[model samples]
Target: MKAVIRITLKNGVLDPQGKAISHALDALGFKGVEEVRQGKLIEIELNENDETRAKQQITEMCEKLLANTVIENYEFELTPVVSS
Candidate 1:
């Protein structure tokens, strides 16, 4: 099974990296670049056969290691792999 997790900052959190990028864009003459935000994607490939178990484990992993639940939000998608 493969799990894809996307982590993003929560709304109302200040994103300094995004702000710096936005400023650079404006300096380079890029117009209409009002806002920018940064996020992370984590893709994990596991050999588990049980899809439900893998999904549960992935969620735990996200909470423990992949994201900070205090200021960030995370979501994951589980995909089953078919072997030939």
Candidate 2:
């Protein structure tokens, strides 16, 4: 199984990195770039074949270590890995 986790800051949380990127873009003449929010993408390959179980495991991983639940939110997508 293949899983992709996306971790991002929640609303109202201060994102200094995102702010810096936005400012840098404006300086580089990337006009009309109103806002920027930075996030993380994690890709994992699991041995588990069951989609439901894989999702559950990934969710737990996110809750325990992949994300800071206090200021961040995480979402994931699961896909079957085809053997070639």
Candidate 3:
């Protein structure tokens, strides 16, 4: 089983890094660079099979170690890849 976690800042949070990226893009003449936000993606491999339990555990992991919940929000998806 593989889990992909995406951590992003909640709306109304100030993202200085994203703003810097946007400014750089504008300096490069990229059109329509309306907005940008930075986030973190984490991939984990596990042996768990139960989707519900696995999601719960992973969400706990995110809350504990993966993300700082003070200003960010995180979501995770579990992918089960069958071996042929």
Candidate 4:
């Protein structure tokens, strides 16, 4: 199984990195972008195949270490691994 997690700063939180990216884009001549919000995408491979158990474990991982729950919000999707 694979867990794909998306973590981003909560609304109203300062995002200096995002701001920097926005500035860089403007300098590069990109137009029409009002804002940029930086985020993290984490993919974890799990030996477990059960969806229920995988979700539970991934949730725990996000809450404990994958994200700063106080300032960041996380959402995840679980997909089955395919072998050729």
Model 1 scores a C-alpha lDDT of 0.92
Q: Which one wins on lDDT?
A: 4
lDDT tens per residue, model 2, 51-83: 989999999999999999999999989999998
Which digits, one per residue and each the tens of the lDDT, describe model 3 over residues 17-50?
A: 9999999999999989899999999999878888
lDDT of 1 by residue, 1-84 (tens): 988899999999999999999999999999999799989988999899798899889988988999999999999888887787
Alpha carbon deviation, residue 36, candidate 2 (Å): 0.3
Q: What is the number of backbone collisions in each predicted candidate, taken in the order shown?
A: 0, 0, 0, 0
Q: What C-alpha lDDT does candidate 3 achieve relative to the native structure?
A: 0.92
The C-alpha lDDT values of all candidates are: 0.92, 0.95, 0.92, 0.97
Cα deviation at 77, candidate 4, in Å, is 0.4
Residues 1-84, model 4: lDDT tens digits: 999999999999999999999999999999998989999999999999999999999999999999999999999999999966
Cα error of candidate 2 at position 8, Å: 0.6
The superposed Cα distance between candidate 3 and the true structure at residue 81, in angstroms, equals: 2.6
Q: Clashes in model 3: which pairs?
A: none
TM-score for all predictions?
Answer: 0.90, 0.96, 0.90, 0.97
Candidate 1, position 20, lDDT: 95
